[model samples]
Target: MSVWDGIVGQEPTVNLLKSVVASPGSGRDDIAQSWLICGPPGSGRSNLARAFAAALISPDQGLSDQPTRVTSQVLAGSHPDVTILSTNKVTIGIDQVRDLIVTSEQMPTTAPWRVIIIEDVDRMLERTTNVLLKEIEEPAPHTIWLLCAPSAQDVLPTIRSRTRVVNLAVPSNTAVADFLIRQEGVDRATALKAARLAQGHIGVARLYATDRQVLADRDELVIGLLGLRRSSDAIILAGRMVDDAKSQAARAVEGQVARAESEFRQVNGLGTDERIPPALRGAYHALGGKDEVRRRTTRLTRDVLDRYLNILASVYRDVCVLQNQADETAGLVNLENRPAITDLSVRLTRRAAIDRLETIATARRRLAGNGSPLLVFEALFCRLLVSDR
Candidate 1:
C-alpha cells in the first residue's frame, strides 16, 4: 500500500507531502527541513509524520516503483536513519532534546536524509523547547525534523516560526466508519456506532468496535454519572473514577516496566533479585533507567486520568444535546448512551447539566496544573452535587 493510504480525510495534505517526496528539492524551501504537524487528538498527526518519513526514506524512483521495504521499515520503526521520539511523560526533558540534537548532527547512514520525529512536542517544557531551538533552527543539511503538536500555538512562537505548519482536521464520521469497515472488517452497524461515539477519532473508534469491555465501561461511566442522585453518591463515584484511572494506568505500564527491567538485568548479568556490591553499584544504577520508567508511569497515570475526565465530559456534552433536543445532524459523541442522555435530560434542568460540564472543565484545568487529582475530583464532585440539587 502507498504510504498515504491509511490517513483519512487529508487528501490535500497527502498530495502536498507526496509532491515534496517525489521531487524533494523542487518544493518551497519552507516545506523542506523542519515541519510542525498540528492536529487535534486522534487526527492522525503522528500517522502523517510517519507516512512522510516513509516516503522520504523510500527510493527516489517514481511513486509507482516506491520501495515497499523502506516504507514498511519506516512504519515499523526499524529504519536506521529514521528516529522517533514519542514520550508518555509529562515533559520532554532537556537531556532528551540534547541527545536528539546530537543525533541530528550525524550524517545519514543509509537514506538520503536522517529524519527525526518528535511526537507531542507540546508536552516539552519551555526550558526543554529552548534547548531544542538552536538545533532545529540550524540542523545539518541532511537532517530533517518532523514535530507533532495539537496546535502551532502549543509550541513556542520562536520554534513555531521556524517550522512549516501542517494542520489536520478531524475526519468525518462516515470516513471513520468506512475506515473501520474496510480495515478492521467491522460490521457497518458496529462501525457507525463506534465512529459516532468516538467523535471521528479513528483510533478510539477502532477500540470501541474491537473491545467490548471498553464499550461496556463507557456505558457504565455514562449511566453512573447520570444517576448520581446524592452528594455521597457523587463523592463515591468520583473516588471510583480516580481509582479506576490509576489502576488502568498501573496495568498499562506494569508489563512494559517488567520487560525493561528484565532486559536491564540481563544486560548487567544480574538475577531478578540480585543487588550489586557497592563498588559496582554505580554501573548498576546507570543501567537501571529507573528515573525514565518512573517518569513514564507518572505521565501514563496522568494521561489515564485525563482520558477519564474526557469521557465524563463527553457524556455531559451528550446531555446538553439531549436537553436542547439538538437534531441528529449535530451528532452525539456517546451514541450508545442515548437512553442515559435522554433520561438525564428529562430528570435534570439544562442549567444543571451545563454547570456539571463546567465543573468537569475546571477539574481538567486543575489537573493540568498538577493539582492533586483527589482534591480536584472531590471539589468537582461537590460542585456537581450542589448543581444537581
Candidate 2:
C-alpha cells in the first residue's frame, strides 16, 4: 500500500500534496516558498508533513526512474540538504533558529530542492522568530519551508504573511476508530471506545486504546479529585500529583534515553562492545541535550496532570450546581461519575457551585503562572470544605 493511504480522513489534503508532487517542477508556482499546516493537537499534522516529504523525495509510483517529476526525501532530521527544526526541549529555543539559518544557506547535496519542516512552530520565542524572519523572507533557491502549528493565530503575522496556509480539521469519531482498527491492529470495540474518549485527538485515542495504565491513571486522578473533602486533602493530593509527574517522566525517559545513547554511540564510530570514545564528544553533547529535553518534558507533563485535576474539580463544581436544581443545560457532563455527581449536585447551591468553578479557574491560571500547585489546591479545597460545611 502507498504511504499516503495511512493518512486517514485527510483525502482533500492528500490530493493537494499529490498534485504538488505531480507538477512538472514540483509546483514552483509562486514566490511564496512556504506552507503552514495548522490544526488542533492529534489531528495528524506531523503525519501529513512526513507523508508529503516522502512523496517529494521518492515520487516513483511504479519504479520507473526518469528523475521522476516528483522525488521527495526524508529530511526528518538536521541534515545538510533537508533540515527539520524541532524542539529537543519542551519549548523550541533561539539556538534552534540559529542552526536553521546556517543550514538554510547551504546548497543542496543531491536533490534539486531543499526542504525544512519545523514542527510546533508556535513554540518559538519572539526573539528567535525575529531571527528567522529574514531568512524566511528571502529564502535561497531550491529551499522550501514547511511549518506546522496548532492554529494560525499561534504564528507571527510576518511569518503568516509569507506562507500559504493550509487548515486541517479533526477527523470524525468513526473515521478515527476505523483508522486505529485497520492500521494499528486495534480491536473495533476498543478503537471505538478510545475514539470517543479522545474527543477527536488521534494520538490520545491511540494512547487510550493501547495503554491500560494511562487510562487507569486518569480515572484514578479523577476519582481522587471527586473525593477531596478538606483543604489539607487538597494540599496532600497536589503533592502526590507532583511526585506522580516526576515518577512518570522518569519512567518514560529511561528506555528512550538508553536507546538514544546507543544510537549516538554507533553514529560516533564506537563499536557495540567498546567503551565510549573520547573523540565522540559531540555525541555526548547530544545526549546532554536529550536529558535537558527530558527535564522540560517532565515539567510539562506535571502541568498537564495538574490541569486534569482542575478539570475534575470543575466537574465537582458542576455537580454542586446540579444539586441546587440549576439549569440542566448548563451542567458539566460527568456521565461516568453520574452517581457521585448527582449526589453532590443535590447537596450544593447554584451559587456555591459557581464559586467552586471560579476557584478551579483561578487555580488553572495560577498553575500557568508557575504557582505552587500545592498552594492553589490547598486554597481550593479549603473553600470547598468550608462551603460544604
Candidate 3:
C-alpha cells in the first residue's frame, strides 16, 4: 500500500528505510545522510533508491500517500529537488559527477531535501570518484546522496567507508512470480514459467512473460548449441548471436534517440521533421545532443551483449540442475527447455557441465574487459561444444 510496495522481497530493508524517514536527525549517528545500496542485477536497487528519495523529499506525507505527483516526479527522475545520474554509458565521466556535486550544494527548491542518486557509482573511474569523496563526506544538512552498485566490494574502500551500506538479496521465485502476476496481470502458469526462467529476476521475469519473441529467441539460442558439431558451425552461430544482440541494442536505442531528438526539436520550437538551421545546428552540438545517438547505441549494445551471455550461462545452469537431480520446482531455471536440459545433462557429466559454466564465466569477464564479441562468443562456443562422449 506504500511506495515501497513496488519493491519485492526486501521487507527488512523497507522497514529500516521507513523508520529512517520517520525519525530523521534525532541525533542518531547510525542514520546516514549517504547510502550505498548493493544488490545483484535485477534486484530493484535503483527503484528502491527512488522510493527512498521520494520519502526524503516529502517525509511528512510521502510514505503514507503512496507518492503523490511530486514524489512520482522523483521516481520518474524529473523532480527539481531530486538529481539522478542514471547513465547508460560504460563509464561515469568526471563531468557528470562534477554536475551532481554542484546540484548537491543547491538547497531544496520545493521539497524537504535535495536528494542526489547515482545509479551505478561503481562505474566511475578512480579519478572521478576522488572528485566526489570529499563532497560526499561533508554534504549540506539538507542534502542526501544515494548510490547503487552490484556489491560493496565493487567500490573502493574510501568510498565505501563514507556511506551506510544496504545489501539486498535476490528475490525468491514465488515472490517474483507473484510480482509478475500482480504487476503484469499474467496468469499463474506464465508467471511461474517466467519466474523460473528469469531465476527470480523481477524485471527479466516481466520481459519473459510479456514477450513471446524474447522467450523464443532465448530457447532457440540454447537449442542451437546442440547443432554446433563443427568449428565452422560454432563460428556461424556466434556471428548470429552477435548480430541479434546488436539488433536488439539498436532497437532499444532507436526509441531513446527519437525521444532525445523530439525534445531537442521541442526546445527550439521546430517541427518534428523540420531541418535545423545552420546556426541552431551548432547549438545542438553544444548541448551534446548530436552525439547522444551514438552514445545510446554504444551503451545499449554493451548491455545487450552482457544480457545475452547471461542467458547463455543460464542454459548450462539448467543442465547442471538436471544432472544433479536437484529439486525440479526450485532449482531449474529453464522449465520450458526441460527437454534440452535433460538432453544436455545426458550428454555431459556434472564435471563437463561445470566446465561449460566456467567457460561462460570467462567469456563474460573477457567481454567486460572489452574483448571483441564475435571472437569471445566463438571461443566460448567452441569450448562449450558437446564433446562429452
Candidate 4:
C-alpha cells in the first residue's frame, strides 16, 4: 500500500511527505533526519509518522541497475538497528534516554539506516529531556528520529528548534465520517452521528461508533452528574465513576492482550516456539506492552471522566446565567435542553451560576491531582448546594 493511503484528510501533508521521500538527495532534503509531528489527541499524528516510516523504508520500484536500497525498520521494542523508547515505568525517566543514546550510537545491522520513534515525547521529564538534547542536537548521519506529541509547545524549546515539525490538524467531521465508512466499514448514518458527537476526534469517534457500552457509560455518567444534588449523592456517583473507569480500562486492555497473543502464535508455530526459550521471552514482552497500554488507557479514561464533569459544571453555569437574565448563550449545554435550560435560568442568578462554574473548575483541577475522588465530589456537591441557598 502507498503511504498516502494511510493518512486521512491531510492532502497537503501527504503531498509534502511524498515529495521528500521521492527526492532523497534534493537541495530541500533537510526534512528527513528528525521530525516533530504535533496534533491533538485523535488528529492522526501517529498515523502520519507510521505512513512516513513505511514510505521511507519501502523497496524502490522500476529502477534500472542496482537500485539504491531503502534499509529501515519500525522498531517498537528492542532492535539492533532501531529503537523505540517510551515510558517503561510511571514516568519517562532519564534512564530511558540513556538507553536510547547508547542505541543511537551503535551501527546498523540489516539496513543502511537506523530509525528511532519516541511516542508521547512530551512526557519526557525535564531531566530526561536534558539528557536527550545532546543526542538530538547531533545525531548519526545514518540515523533518523521521529517524535510524536500533542503540541509543539509541550516539548522543550531546544528540542523543537533541533527538529522540523509536521503539524496535523483535526480532520473535518465529514472527513472523519468518510474515513469511518470507507476504512472502518461503519454505516454512514452511525458514522455521521458519531463524528458529530466526537467533535472531530477520530479515536473518540471510532469508540463512539463501534462501542455501544462506551456510549452508554458516558450517557450514564452525564445523567448521574445532572441528578446529583446532595453530598451523599455526589460521593456515591464518584465511587461508581471510578469503578466504571476501571472496568472499561480493563476490558479494553484485555482485548488488546488477546489480539497480541493471537498474533504471536500465528507468527511462530505453536509447538516449535514453545520449545524455543527466546519465544517465551518475546511473549512476555508482548504482554508487558499490553499492560503498559492498559495503564495508559486507564489514565485516559479518568481524563475523559473529568471532562464530562466539566461539561456538567458548564450546564449549571448556564443555569446561573439564565437566572440572572444575562446572555442566554453564556452557559447553555445543548441549547436544545430548552425546557430544563429555561427552568434553571429562572431559578438561579448569574452570580450564583458563575460561582458554581468556578467550583466545578476547581474540582476538575483538584481531581486531576492526587485527591480522594469521593472527598472531592463531596466538597463540590456541598458547595454547589450551599450556593443554591
Candidate 5:
C-alpha cells in the first residue's frame, strides 16, 4: 500500500505531500525544512505527518520493497529517525522542547532524514514555543520539523511565518461513514449516525459508533440541556458536568498512574509498603510526587471539559440548523436528538440559538483561561435558560 493509504479524505493534501516526498531537495524551496499542518480536530494531521515521515524515511519513497512495513513502523512509533512528541497533558513544557532541540542538532541514525513531529503544537505555552523557534527556522541540512495544530491562528506569527503551511479540509459525513465501514467493519446505519454526530471528526465518529457509554453520555448531555428550566436546574446541571469531566479524566489516567507508580517503585528499589530511605526521599519525591499526579489529573479534567463543551456547542448548532431549515441534503450532527432540537427550535428563535452557541464559545474561552468549569458552565446555562424562555 502507498504511504498515504490510511489517511481518509484530504486528497489535495496527500498529493502535495507526496510530491514533496518524491522530489526532496530538488531546489523546491516551498517544501521547507519546517512545515505546519493545520486542520480542525480529527482531520488526521498527525496521521498525515506520520505518513510523510514514513515516505521520507523509506529508501525508495513509496516504492520500497516493504513500504507498508516502513509506514507501519512509523505509525507504531518504532522508527528511530522519526521522533513524535505527543502528550495528553494540557500544555507542552519547555523542558520537552529542550530535549527535542537536542535531537534536532543530531545527524540521522538510519534514515536519510531525521523528522520530528510535534502533535498539538497549539497547546504549547508561548515560552515553550519560543524555545524551538530558532531550531525550526534554521535546522540542519537533513532535519525536518512537522508541527500540527487546530488552525493557523493558534500558532505564533514568528513560527508560522518561517514554516510552510499545509491546510487540511474536514471530511464530510459521507466520507467519514464510508471510511468507518471499510476500516472498522461498522454497519452503514451506525456509521452514518456516528459520522453525522461526530461532525467531521473521524476519531469521535469511531468512538460514538462503537462505544455505548459514549453514546449514552452524549444523549444525556443534549437531553439535559434541552430540559433546563430554571436557574436552579442550570446550577445543578453545571455541577454534574464538572463532576462528569473529573470522573472521565480520572478513569482515563488511572491505568497510566498505576503503571507509573509501579515503575517508579521498581527503579527506586522500594516496595509498595516500604518506607523511603532518608537519603533517597528526595529522589523518590521527584520521581513520583503527589503534586505531579494532581497536575496531570487537572490537565486531563480540563481536556475532558473541553470535549464536553464541543458537544454542548453542537446541540445549539443543530438547533440553529433546524430553525433555519438548512440544506436538505446535509444531515444534522445530532440527528438522533432531532425531536429535542425541533422542540427547541420552535420555542427559541434562530437568533436565540445563535446566542446560545456564542455562550458556549465564551464558556470554552473562560475554561481555557484556568477559570472554573463549574462557574463558567453555570453562568452559560443560566444565559441559555433566558434565551430558551
Candidate 6:
C-alpha cells in the first residue's frame, strides 16, 4: 500500500510532496530543504510529514515503490538519517531547538539526505525560534526540515517566510466515514454518525467509532452542562468537570511515563521501584525526568479541558442549527443528543445558544492562556446558567 493510505482527503498536498520526491529542483519551492505543513487538528499534518520523509529517504523516490524495509524504518522514526521530535510538553524550549540545530548541521550518514520532522513547531517559544532562524536561513545541503503546525500565523513571520508552507484541508464527513470503515472496520451507520459528531477530525472520528465510553462521557458532559438550573449548582458542577478532565489526562500519561521509566530502569539494570544513586540521577533529570513529566501532565490537562469545552460547545452548536435550519435533522453535530438538544432549543432563543457557545470559546482561550482551570470553569458554568424567566 502507498504510504499515503489512510490519510483522508489531502490529495493535493500528497501529490505535491510526491512530485517533490520524483523530480527535485524542478522549482525552487519544490525541493526546498525547509518546509512547513499546516492544518487544523486531525488533518494528518504529522502523518503527511513522516510519509514525505519516507519517500524522500527511499531510493525509489515514489510513495508506492518505496521498499518495505526503508518505509518501515522512516515511519517508525528509526532511520539513521532521519530525526523525529514530538513533545508532549506545552512548549519546545531553547535547549531542544539548539539540539535540533546541531542535528540539522550533520551530514547524511546513509541516505542521500538527512530529514528532521518536528511536530507542533508552532509551540516553540519565540526566543527558541529566533535561535532556530539562523540555521534555517542557511541549512546544510543534505539536511531537510519538515515542520508541522496548526497554521503559518502560529509561528513568527520570519520563520514562515523561510519555509515553504503546505496547507491541508479538513476531510469531509463522507471521506472520514469511509476511512473509518476501511481502517477501523466499523459499520457505515456508526461511521457516518461518528464522522458528523467529530466535525471532520479523523482521530476524534476513530475514537467516536471505536469507543462506546467516549460517546457516553461526551453525553454526560453535555447533559450536565445543560441541566444546570441554579447558579450554585453550576459552580458545583464546574468543579466536578475540572476534576474529571484532570483525572483523564493523568490516566492517559501515567502509562507513558511508566513504560519509559521501566525501559530506562531495565537498561540500567535496576529493579522496578529501585532508587538510583545520586550520580546516575543527574543524567536522568537532565533528560527531563520529573520536570518534563510535570509539564506534560499540565499540557495534557489543558488538552482534556479543551475537549470538554468543545463538547459543551457542540451541544449549543446543534441547538443553534435546530433553531435556524428549515430541517431540524440537517447539520447537527451531536445527533445522538438530538432529543435533549431539540428540547433545549425550544426553551431558549437562538441568541441565547450562540451566547453560550461564545462563553465556552472564551473559557477555552482562557484555559490555553494559563488561567486557573477551576476558576475559569466556575465562571463559565455560572454564566451559562439559563434563566427561568
Model 1 stretches with alpha carbons more than 4 Å out: 24-31, 60-67, 254-297, 346-352, 386-389
Candidate 2, residue 311: lDDT: 49
> Which rank order by lDDT, best down to worst?
5, 6, 3, 1, 2, 4
Question: Model 1: how far is 300 from its true place, Å?
Answer: 2.8
Candidate 2 per-residue C-alpha lDDT over 1-389 given as tens digits, one digit per residue, 9 for 90 to 100 = 46576676788888887777777766556334688889887788987776666566564631243324342335234334556776645568888788887877777786566777899999887888889888787887777888999999999998888788888888877899999988789899888877766667787778779878666666666666668776677677767766665665566566566777787777776776777666776767666586676675667565555546544665765576566556365544345776777766666667767777777777777775667766766666666653453
| Residue-level lDDT tens digits of model 3 in 64-103 | 6445887778877789998889887678999999989988
lDDT of 5: 0.83
Report the number of backbone clashes for model 3.
0
- Using TM-score, give the best candidate's number: 3
Q: What residue pairs are clashing in model 6?
A: none
Which run of 10 residues does model 1 get worst, by summed lDDT? 59-68
Better of 1 and 4 by lDDT: 1
Q: Which residue pairs collide in model 5, if any?
A: none
List the candidate 5 regions with Cα displacement exceeding 4 Å. 24-31, 60-69, 255-296, 327-329, 386-389
Instruction: Please give the distance, in angstroms, between residue 206's alpha carbon in candidate 5 and its true position after superposition.
Output: 1.8
Model 4, global lDDT: 0.69
Candidate ordering by TM-score (highest first): 3, 6, 5, 1, 2, 4
lDDT by residue (188-260, candidate 6, tens digit) is 9999998988888888889789878666767778778768899888888888878877776667677677776
lDDT of 6 at 324: 84
Greater-TM-score candidate between 1 and 5: 5
lDDT per residue for candidate 5 within 56-140, as digits (tens), equals: 7776575454566666788778888889999867789899999999998899898778899999999998999899999989988
Q: Give residue 107's error in model 1 in angstroms.
A: 0.8
Model 2 RMSD in Å is: 4.9
Model 4: how far is 240 from its true place, Å?
A: 1.9
Model 4 residue pairs with clashes: none
Model 5 lDDT, residue 176, Cα: 91
> Which scores greater on lDDT, model 4 or model 6?
6
With candidate 3 superimposed using the best TM-score fit, by how many Å does residue 86's alpha carbon deviate from the native? 2.0
